[model samples]
Target chain A: MNQRDPLKRVLYIDLSRKSFWIDDRVDLFERWLGGIGVAVQLFKEEAPKNIEPLSPENPVIFSIGPLTSLYPLASKTVALFKSPLTGNLGESHAGGRSAIAIRLAGYGAIIIKGASQLPLYLVIKEGEVEFRDGSALWGISNANTVGRILREAAIGRGIRTIMRIGKAGEKLVSYAAVITETYRHFGRLGLGAVLGSKKVKGIIIYGKHSIPIQDKKKYREIYDRLYRLAVGSDAMKRYHDLGTAINILPLNYIGALPTRNLNSSRFEGAEEICGENIAEKKLARRVACAHCPIACIHIASIREPYPDEPYFYKTTFISYDHELLYSLGSMLGVKKIDDVLRLIDTVEAMGLDAISTGVCLAWATEAYKRGIITINETLVELDWGNIDNYIQVIKYIVEQPNDFYGMLARGTREASKHYGGQEFALNFGGNEMPGYHTGYGAIIGYSIGSRHSHLDCAGYRVDQTIKEPPSPEEFVELLIKEEEWRQILNSLTICLFARSIYNVENIIEALKPLGYNYTEEELKKTGEEIYFEKQKLKLKLGFKPEELKIPSRVFETPTPHGLLKREYIEEALQHYIKLIEYKTLQ
Target chain B: MYVSSHEVKRLAILDAERCVGCQLCMFACSRRFGDGGLAKSAILVRSVGGIERGLTVIVCRACLDPPCARVCPTDALKLRKHGGVFLDQTKCIGCRNCVEACDIGAVFWDYETNKPIICVHCGYCSQFCHYKVLGVEKTI
Candidate 1:
């Protein structure tokens, strides 16, 4: 890393003390690169082991990378903290103006430590940090309203990012998310709860600093080439065209949709709520993260009439993608596109992780059907595809009106512990299951994954290619290889959608003009090191591979590769454990 | 070296609706001067209130009679045949008269140099705009 590069700066804010300081972390940046690599290192250094994830001791570290703002598609910001949801390593990536804002703000990472006694929001500008009273904004129900208020209240309109939590965060729902730029989020695991626990309502980052390049001509040449590839490539066309929601119909057809708590793998009404239908009917606009040419963020315009006024109507724009379409639509058996959008809107408003919320609701609805839970506990009928009841339940989850809703707020794993629905509760590593039932790869991948996210390593994609499942050793190797490479991509903080464009060669080429000269071999080694560092943290934080639960519902429901065998997943998981242990020992 | 006003080409927002708010044009503009980052970029694309509302591309509109040039007390900002102002760095007193004068907020400042960074109507940024939101048009 260049000594003069602002990316070498780390901003440490002690919320409890109301103090801020800048540390030149060239050693950390040069060694780990940036984003997840640097973030894991920061988390390990700052966060103590086995501490309560919601405690003020848990540090929330947000880090970007060298490629941010300088290159297209290097637009994601990685947030790392101890997850209140999983009680393990919590890591989430979000794209918007976050990476650009933080980078331009002249910091590679921001470590927010300690807890505030009173509610507050942080305004981080070019060289200053302001701790503002967030008492008025604290209990604001709608996340969008908070954004609106802050947008008006704060400066830096064009080059800024506003990351806030809603009622879910305020109430400390385990799956609560930190919404950034309204549409994007640090949306998985319990980053919001961590922020909520700290009494930090929101954070606004704005900066306008120029990055000096080592070789301007080389930088432009590489940039133009990448830009051409990004725009001209067919790999990114699907994302720009209909976005990830395009996976809905295809996944549904292959019987991997995981509908109604995995009671069935396929949704009959998948066509109605698929990407094509939504794009045709409701797609109001497409937006992009800063520096990304592929505007994959699809916002749907939902216009509805007010019940009180027959003539008056209001239009709402809600962002939707495949995960949302699956988790809120198919998982809940929501056939109507509007209902799915409405459910998504409700989830966003409350600032809950849509996947966890949907999966939790699916479990609750099943438990209700089985007479395990009743209307007395639910206060409303938990029915599949019932948007109104789901909406009410979503609110209750955040509000925690009862013991049942409180358990639901913790996520399905905890909800089922008392409710007698353990077998069907779709959670892996205590985090709610992502929308994939492809095969063993998906199950075992989630089981052993650092964050237990499908994005950790796309096991679902492996399921798509195989005629016969690979040996446990082979499968683990495949997963580990992809995941290791992904560490490099995540460190660059490039949008995973542009994975094809930023291959190893391109990544090396891209970093060259930025002053970091890395060989392919060194890059690969860095990836492995980053992955192992995260694994070590997860282990220290008390993640056990042998104890990972493979929901019985995954086996019961037929996947694209037919019914997945429990034995195969266990073998694969064991192989993964052995491999990771061997690597960690080294 | 004065060119005919009719032959002068200026960067234009061909279709503002096509902008996805990627701000690649902004980066491209900054990169044209041999650096990376938004500090040097004269073009600014921002959401119209919130992103859900859509985006507004703010750049030099190349007004027929530019307000930015007219307000330059130091005569640092010279009107180009293309209609946009050309900043003479040596002459710029760093007064920021042009920055406040532009109603559309097109004149951007380079804090490091303490001078105004204005677009010279170079089509470099337009080449990188995939959505066709930006282009170079002859003032004629």
Candidate 2:
């Protein structure tokens, strides 16, 4: 409410002009708050209607909330961009130092626009922006190497975020990811390809500043309360114990695992890549974000025996979670945990979104099995669980040795469109599917949600737990409510892992000392507003509910619940449209 | 060493191996001084390279006869009872002499007002340290 609000200032950078400035948009922050709520408004203003996703006009908006750096688990940075993968509203959240750095760097949001003529990496430090030449760093295949080079070049340590792309982004793979802080990522919906289109290699932001709390005593009280709950809660405690990969065995046992391109929903080799196995066999270390007490980032030391040397082996460090395990392990029929780890490592190094890559490969393998194509088209044989051949295909996807590999690099939707296999492409709204195959909940959530992301709706929880099967209309209504509620989480950019602790009342209370006074009713209204605004943005961008593709494989596959019927899903979709229309009229 | 010290109540890295690099200590230290952020944090935790190798918890060693105090041109940093340096901010010119003189790089600069932020040997941060990597010990 005051002119001294440093957190309200949004840093704007124009790569084409090589110009940068800070815009004090206190009014926007006042009305929308920060993170996704503010980011969506900025994206609407910056990205022209129906702008090509890879065009210079598309904007990249990274935002953190007032709670950032002031509380535990307020540690996620929301990135909003037009997805090159989906061609719709794009949003992703990443942890590590991204939020902490941006918040401490003294900005509420950063909006980068326009493509540069030459390769450059923007460095923000000490209240200034410098476009460092990235010619030498370009074409370096590994994302880790890019992070390393940038880390050395960047001045500030302990409080800095280094975000960069790798071979996939450089090659304009539609599902490329932007790796941040080496082990974390803005990993979904082709944010990296969008950055690649701008000719920007990466961004390094570092600063030393503080957020001004309105009431220090109340702040400390709330901080300790939240910290205690965060560490003490049983449900939340599992995040650090086995990490999210703990879901593998349970999900597989329940028959909701989505193995081998959804030909089956359970995998036989679940234990090999399951959480307990990975933790006991390979866990190298556990790390946390700057302000978070939960060290959820689990890195594994994957040691592989050399082919030529009988006794020699090489160890590689790779971060793994449920999504990668599902996408690369069960989904691909990768029997060996080391094989899944190696594939994950390859995806990380190449900066490819593992979900899309695995889904694309799965679709290809199935397509090949049905004689949709031959070895002449795919230089390497497309076989399930064949790590050797899959590894070659992954490299081929990045390098694009042939037409099939090039189409596969684009993503599942495009690849299937070209070579046949539309029924089992397994992409929702043109973005690759996540690791959930619960039932209608996951299907409706992924197909009809704002970003077409499971996190947006998280209906898998509803599917896995609900005893009574609700009506199709009720299902649609529940998903809408779920998504609208998640607007608050993504808006605060809080990690969904801490959803139980970040209840609406707790959120409102958390905002008080951080200088935001919001009532429970007001927060709910704000969440609905953010949700509607994103839906409106997507509608403007040609995302049509009527045209939403429902993959038939989802219907054929028997989930933990039962067979998901196409007719039932369509009924839900129809109900969802009517509900949104009614909300719009109101 | 402080000329009149009887017992040293200084912060110690009791076990660096226990650190998960959450950096709650940084925010806790800053909060103790004033606000709830890292601007005033004197202690730091960073990965040795990647997080795979683990954390390097860097803090003022609370050196006996601290070089930061010796290099203070304005005598702004006086030796504390626990072997750390305490800054008299009114006397500090923001010349960064103490920041440069510290070999361990524990001296942090506050960018807003441009002053060297140093730990005063308080163990307020150790309370928030869930990993128990830090402690307040009475050392001889």
Candidate 3:
């Protein structure tokens, strides 16, 4: 890394004392690269052992990479903390102005520690920081409204990013998400609740600093090559056309959609809410994160008339992808696309993780139907495709008026323990299942993944491609290989959708003009090191890979690969544990 | 009167609705200086309100009698043959009068040099705009 690089600077803020300072962390960036790599090291250094995730002692770290702002598609920011949802390693990546904002602000990473005594928001500009009073903005029901208010109040119009939470976060719902740029989010594992716990309302960051390059001619050459590949090739066409929602029809066609709490794999009404339908009838426009040419973000327009005045209509734009369609649509058996969009809009407004919220509601619906929970526990009836009742229950989950709602707010893992529907809870390693019910690989991937996310290894991809399922050892090996490689991409903080375009060769070439000289082997080794560091931290935080419980509903439903046996998944889990432990020892 | 031989070319916003707010053009504008960043770019793109409303592309409209040149107190801003203005950095006193005069907010600031960065109408940025939202036209 260059000594003159602003990426070497680390900004530290302490809310308890209302102070901030900078340190030249060249050593940390030199060893770990950046993004998740730097974030994991910082988390280990700043966080105390056995600290509660909501406590001020839990550090919130945001980090970007050297390749950011210099190259196309390398525009994601990695946020690391101890999760309020899983009580373990919390890592989420978001693409928007977040990475560019932080980088141009002239820092490789920002670390926030301690809690404020009152509601507060921080405005960070180039070489300056302001701690503003957020007393009036506190308890705002809609997250979008918070963004709107702060947009008017803050500076840095286009180049800035505003990250804020909603009522779910304010109430400490374990699955609450931190909304960024109105569309993207740190959308998993309760980073929002952690922010809420610290009494921090929001953060706005922007800058006008310029980044230097080693060789001007080489930089232009590589930049042109990447830009041409991104724009000219078909590799990113699907994302640009329909976004991730394009996966819905195909996944449903293959019987891996996870409809209605995994009672069935395929949804009968999937055609109504799939990507093609939404793009045809509902898509309002497409947008992109800063520096990304793909423009994969799809926003849908939903117009409805006022109840009293038939002629008066209001149109609302809601962002949607495959995960939302599956979770809020097929997972809950809601067939109408408008109804699904409304559910997505509701979850977005309340600042909830759409996947976890839908999974929780799905479990409750099954529990209600089975006579395990009555209407007394749920103020409204829980039924499949009941949009109005589901919306009411979503509100109750945040308000938590009753004990049942309180338990539900904690997550399905806790809610099922008390409510007696553990088999249908559909959570892996305490985090709710994503849209995939592909086979053994998806289940095993969730259980052993560092963040319990499908993106960690994308094992579902393996299930989708393979004709014959591999043995448990082979399956674990394949996942480990992919997961290790992904650490490098994430360290650069590139959007995973551009993985095909940013192969190891291209990544090595791209770093040259930025002054990072590294061989392919050295980069691979760095990736492995970052992965192990996260695993070590997870172990320190009391993660037990062997103890991960698999909900029986996954086994009951037939996947595209046929029925998944519990013993086979358990075997894969053991193999994963052994491999990881063996690597840790070395 | 003798005119400069340089072609009177200026970047134009062809279709604001087609812009996805990628800001690739802005980056391309900065890259002409042999670096990668948004600091020196003379073009700006932002969402109208939220991204849902659509985007507005801000650039030099290449006016026949540019207001920026008229408001330049230092006489640093010179009018191009047909339209637009170019900055004479040596004479500029950094008054920022030209920045305030441009109602469209096309005159971006170079914070490092503490000078106003005006578009040269190279059309380099238009080449990178895949959506055809931007184009370059030669004016007489």
Q: Which DockQ values do the candidates obtain, in the order shown?
A: 0.87, 0.73, 0.75
Model 1 segments more than 4 A misplaced: B1-7
User: On a 0 to 100 scale, what is the lDDT of residue A185 in model 1?
Assistant: 94
Candidate 3 per-residue lDDT, tens place, A307-350, comes to 99768999999999999999999999999999999999999999
- CAPRI class assigned to model 3: medium
Share of real interface contacts recovered by each model?
0.87, 0.77, 0.68
TM-score per candidate, chains pooled:
0.98, 0.97, 0.99
TM-score of chain A by itself in each prediction = 0.99, 0.98, 0.99
The residue pairs found clashing in candidate 2 are B1-B65
Cα lDDT computed for each candidate against the true fold: 0.91, 0.87, 0.91
What DockQ class does candidate 1 belong to?
A: high
lDDT of 2 at A124: 87
lDDT of 1 by residue, A1-586 (tens): 6677899899999999999999999999999999999999999889756788998899999999999999999999999999999999999999999999999999999999999999999999877999999999989989999999999888889799999999899999999999999999999998999999999999999999999898889998999899999999998999999999999998988889989999998899899999999999999999999899999999999989999978899999999999999999999999999999999999999999999999999999999999999998899998899999999999999999899998889999998998888999999999888888888788877887788999998998898889888898798889888899999999999999999999999999999988899999999999999999999888898888778888898889999888888888888888888988888888
- Candidate 1 share of real interface contacts: 0.87
Candidate 2, residue A442: how far the Cα is off, in Å: 1.0
Give the candidates in order of lDDT, highest first.
Answer: 1, 3, 2
